[model samples]
Target: MVDVTELQRQHIEKITKEKKLITIKECSTLTGIGERKLRELVHVSGFPCIRFGKKCMIVSSLIDEWLINHIGETF
Candidate 1:
């Protein structure tokens, strides 16, 4: 039988990688940045985050732009 579990995992991974808006945890994983630092960044002005009540989502596409804009700078 085909390994449905492995297939499902692969599918999920593909979906997450293709996602435009992702949770803080996913953003940390994708950017190799620690969750703690990411949480702080989300609160900074012009950092680019969508808030839903207490839940916060990071825009995947803006990550690169943010990094480039902050080059040679520290938060």
Candidate 2:
């Protein structure tokens, strides 16, 4: 049987693999945007992301540029 905690650990490991690509959690930490809000923002056009299975891998640079464009130059 698959333990729930084990599944969660794998998910965490997948999301935090340490690279230029990062997960919603890391993006949220860097951008101060809530994870749920970040997920919603993903549906917007031209939001840079990659999908591996069910995980949404966000590019740190793209999100930064996105915020600056959408929010304001001050962002």
RMSD per candidate (Å) reads 4.8, 8.2
Q: Give residue 18's lDDT in candidate 1 (0 to 100).
A: 92
Question: Can you give the lDDT of residue 17 in candidate 1?
Answer: 70
Q: What is the TM-score of each predicted model, taking all chains together? A: 0.75, 0.66
In angstroms, the error of model 2 at 68 is 0.6
Task: Tell me the tens digit of each residue's lDDT in model 2 across 1-75.
Answer: 879878766664565465668878887866778999889877677888887888888986567687777764221
TM-score of 2: 0.66
CA error at residue 63 for candidate 2, angstroms: 1.4
Tens-digit lDDT string for candidate 1 (7-75): 867864674679878888877766778999999999999997899999999887787798889999888
Task: Give the Cα error of residue 57 in candidate 1, in Å.
Answer: 0.2
- lDDT top scorer: 1
What residue runs in model 1 are displaced by over 4 Å at the alpha carbon? 1-17
Candidate number with greatest TM-score: 1
